[model samples]
Target chain A: MADRSSKRRTLRLKTPISAEDIADFRLGDVVYLDGLIYTGREGVYKRVVDEGAELPVDPAQVGNVNFHCSPAAAVREDGSYNVGAVTATASFRFAKWLDRWFEISGCKVIIGKGGMTSEAYRKHLVPQGAVYLTTVGYGTGALLGRGIKRVVAAHWLEDLGIAQAMWVFEVENFGPFLVESDLQGNSLFERANAEVAKNLDALYEGLKPPVMSRYGETDDRKDELI
Target chain B: MISTQTLQNVAEELMAKAAIEIPDDYLAGVKGMAETEEGDLSAFVLRAMLENYEAAKEDRRAMCADTGVPRWFVKLGNEARIEGGPVALEAALRRATASATHEIPLRPNRVHPLWRTDHNNNVGLNAPEIDYSFEPEANWIDLTAVHKGGLFGTDYRMLFPGDGIDGIKRFLLDTLIAFGKRGLACQPAIVGIGLGGSKDTCMVLGKQAACLRTVGNRNPDPRIAALEMELKDLGNSIGMGAMGFVGSSMVIDCHIEAGFTHTGGMPMSVHAFCLSSRRATARVHADGGIDYRTDPKWFTPYMRRETVEWQTDPASGARSA
Candidate 1:
């Protein structure tokens, strides 16, 4: 048995767990992780790469990487955990710089919502042996439920707030999520979109309104509440 | 005495319960259509609807509470894989959502022809909403579970939850224009306008607007944020009630994304909101796996039921008391 109780794991880089190890993780499976990972999102990443300052992280300790947007924006002087829900947002603007994010953080798994586009998935993902995945959308509260504590990198807190906070946490489980994009460049975005278009076209062509609509002949619309 | 945590839990349990209780108003709309429409096509539509209702009833779920807004935007990662069936994603979504509606016994909000009726569950204009955005990630996919808020008109609320929001639309609209004007930081040019409902339908346009794919940020530049800030103030000034009558933040927080204006045209729209803001999310790994990524730091057990009970005062409701 893995003696699940006593293992102390720090937030590390995105570790390359084989398909065998990772496949076991389900949409709602909880797992304690042990590895090195860097933490950076929008503003956090900007400070590190843009400022060219001494890395707040101990390069030797970082194993993998984690990314989230709009994390806790305010710094609490008392050191009590500042709770928040996080999700990946608007990565299109940063695609050009994505490869660098991976290289710097050595992240194998980048978690975000909305499947990525084709070009970015292929060029940046496959060659690097990286993978991408999606979670249910707007599930903020349920998603935020997993945060256990704050393992602050000390100085990093001063530098980053919402976009750059380096707060590592112990997650309960990785959930009942599905893969939309893969190392081979397959994408859910393209597939889901095609289905939408097809459905829309069918709806437009098939349904027609009756000469006398059901809600009565009068068009007393303006006064109605929304 | 409901704390934020208690409120959240109540929001989840009772609201989810309400979702299951299919309202007569919605089902009535669907039933009314089944006997009237003519032709094989009508039959086809009727059959599809039957299946949807069946799934909802059997599973005790909602037909389509527009889970898409949360599912498409919240907990998603870079990739997603659906293996259960060859059924198209959209088709499966419709079926699943329909199942949810029927099971939850939620009111069917979909209606026909411009007059939106809560017949059965077929509200017009794709009553269910979904939004999307680009994302990046490792192998683990993310799934966002959301408890969305609903804004119904003040009237006909007893008839259906969808009806309560109608009474507040005027105040809401007035607030939107005020936000874009000199009163707020809103710059007329780069706005994404959302006009809900066809002047007549009981359908909710504002809630739909909130679910719409945004044109851009409510504030990209300082000018935009300033406009948003000003609007917030002015909107409250009108004294719109709790549902915008006595006045609250009429536009909520004008979230700004980035967008370009067409010449001098100031674009803006009214966005309605679901009340709960109930949603959840999780993530998948590189090999097509997931980590039900709940931020443990915030997950308190308070949401769960307790043995103790509290008393309520005569204040009935002191405005969110």
Candidate 2:
């Protein structure tokens, strides 16, 4: 394990990541970030993409990195904020909003849990020159929280509430994310899944099928539920 | 009588402990898995998780940002009495949940399903579900807080008696492989299997088996215990590990809880308590003394009584009513 991990490359890139910076990134490379990143998911996506609500903060001002997350946060009585452990949500569910989101937000990096499919990367992210970095452990929330230097602002707290609100953060060394998808749409998870799938059929060799079967989206074990 | 104040205070502390601390049994299990994990990426993930636990403890913050849907499991001693009745107990639990959500600054994950309303607190309609059980010959209440992730790695099926163990294995593999991909289910988990119950009961038992029981603990029934070991080995044998990488760390432990069911049907459910595996328990004595611990010790002999009457001597295992 150590030998394999030793061979993997690690990098740290600043926010508003450039095409040149991410172009050489390979699937499974470790990455850390420095500068501003904002949180947005279903609520923010619906408000801006579907409901036509203008973004409360300009994308250029906040930088182009978007995190699919909500912080364990609270607002103090003095109208200040207390932001604790920060972790990512599954990014697959937001694939639908990606195209429009990229158009509106100019996001160049997507940090989240469970990287999107390679197809999603090719269609939605490749054109925008964006890449996906997944949080380590599907989290490392407390470590990530320690990386946060300050909460720049939180928008839509009244309307969307804390979980759904858009939060902009100032961060430094803010990740231990793995590069799940690269510029050419190659995905680390898909590669891993393919290798694991090779041994799957043999595991069920003698296990007979159930007497009763229910309707499902797919019966293929190799296929992902996402 | 236990005062509502003590209950509320203990409940609040349990909430924080559940969110911030990785219980010892689970931590030890993961450490063992990490040592043996061969997949490079999987090993890296395990190492990172270990570090994250230390970070959480040092910083006094939640181990996972998605803090999961907070819920309570209360065990009341047959002789235990609260200053107020069940209604007041419920209120105290709710108040503690709300207060801790703000204090621990837990992410308010609960919402009004259709309307999408957020209370900025975990409290809501049927939220923070409190489950109950009773223990004989004691005068204390046990409060266990389980912060289990709400998505992926769970499934239910109605299998016939004829389906047998092979059928159960198939379903387990199916659920594990499906959600185990991309680490969606957060593999290397404590996988719990619920067998021989009605559909809802199957779901509940499976969840309790995962969240309430500690690692290395086995069911009382000898046959069930052996099956648990078999399932645990079978899960780890799947060439999958942390983050769905190819390796042998899919399950750190497996637990099964069974119930008498319909004669013709053997319903089953599978639940995965993920990498975080957040839970903490406290016993509040009638004299208002509180004792905190990691293990829930929920499945007592009396709770799993096979006969119609409570007849077993808890201390001696003798048959007496």
Candidate 3:
């Protein structure tokens, strides 16, 4: 069932999202984060997790939220990264590292598109005080306009290219992010899927099969709900 | 003859438009969905999406970071005359991509697939994947540039002939559900389905349907058109609302196209496009006239499907229930 709340507001947050702050969030809650957030994705994760390289920011000061993104920017002649657009990429491929990312980076919130796939992340999250928030897939422009305030520090523009480098941003009121996975191990997506399965069952409940087997299918597909 | 400069300018303008701005049709669809969305969260998300589009346009900033690798679908007239021909045209497209990277400034998305070396200019071997079609009597060149988003990719499936249309429908629904499970590929998705043909051809048609077709358009084949409508309704009913928030308007549109297939096998491909649906079209005439349009008219050569008629209420802007 859809939440019928007519009024929606953004909850402004400070840096280092505490366990209490994240635990208070329910699945589907909308919030705005204003503080220091570090960005990392496939390339940085590969370097940190697989290659055992040291991250530039110390785990303690990197704050609670870590954005999973490969930002788009034009490298200026002065060597500073200009903010063109910053959008979340899918975080499923890096699912194995979700817990480790929290452990190593001390970030309790992971911001990315297409929520985490690994059930292991859920299990790891509850104890470690973490959650997964989903940015609107097409809200990248809004993210650039309002979410990101400015680029603070950047590493690996030369080594990893503009898209994959680790960019630290000073963000102000940075989200209308949906809490896809909460600290309680609850996922809005899992609930939605359960509903979808029911809807699929109901859709095929009483359909009759066509008289002619248009293609030469040996098996009878009449009324079988896939 | 179309000069090298003309081709380059057309490419640059189209790519820039596609990268930075949300085409008018897609914006209308998003607005319509926002009006009709059943879930509050979905509605909120839809409005946010519209704001994003507006902000990007007003700021002249690239909407989403993944300005995507360019996918060109070019239709050349038989009577078309050019100075350097296809080779020159290809060179112009490549150069435009490089130029646009700095102007609209597209994200350098092209990376060496195996070696992971970044091209930094969005140009590599077969960088801008280009496809061509020829119209024998026409004397113009029509190009549709689709900025294929780098978020997720097209879904493909091949089945034996015996599996039938039912199997195909199930595959599509299942694929959509899976996408929804993985946060629903940016919400209110535009689903493109390809039926029949070989693996690659079906995938191409699906891409065309997703990237080229407009929101309210229908397929020409009656049966296929009916399937399109059914899938659109069914997929929405799944309630994977904006970004997997449970809601009624999960999909904005479903575009399907079919081609002749082999006797032994059936191929069905699905491509899910985010609400952004970035695309732009340009037509260069023999008289040196150039026209730019948001609509690609991919189905211009095909027939219109006559399925069930829908009546809309003007006051409420709602289809008759």
Docking quality (DockQ) for each candidate: 0.01, 0.72, 0.35
Question: Which stretches of candidate 2 lie above 4 Å from their native place?
Answer: A1-3, A217-226, B314-321
Q: For model 2, what is the C-alpha lDDT against the true structure?
A: 0.91
Task: Locate the minimum summed-lDDT window of 10 residues in model 1 chain B.
Answer: B296-305
Instruction: Give the winner by lDDT.
Output: 2
Worst lDDT run of 10 residues, candidate 3 chain B, spans: B312-321
lDDT of 3 at B274: 77
lDDT of 3 by residue, A78-170 (tens): 866667767777777777766666678877888887776437555677677788888875556535545677888888777888778888888
Docking class of 2: medium
Residue-level lDDT for A75 in candidate 2: 98
> Which ranges of candidate 1 are over 4 A from the true structure?
A1-38, A72-77, A147-155, A206-226, B1-321
Per-candidate TM-scores read 0.38, 0.97, 0.87
Per-residue accuracy of model 1 over B1-321 as CA lDDT, tens digit each: 112222223223333433333333323433443444332222222333334444444544433333223222222233444344223433433444444433333333344446423334322356444333323332233333333432222111111123222222333343343332211211111112232223322223223223321222233236645655554444333332111111122333333222232342222234333222223333434443334321211111121112364223213232110
Sequence-dependent TM-score of model 3: 0.87
Cα RMSD (angstroms) for every candidate in the order listed: 24.0, 3.1, 6.6
TM-scores for chain B, listed for all candidates: 0.43, 0.98, 0.91
What's the true lDDT of residue A1 in model 1? 12
lDDT measured at residue B261 in model 3 versus the true structure, 0 to 100: 83
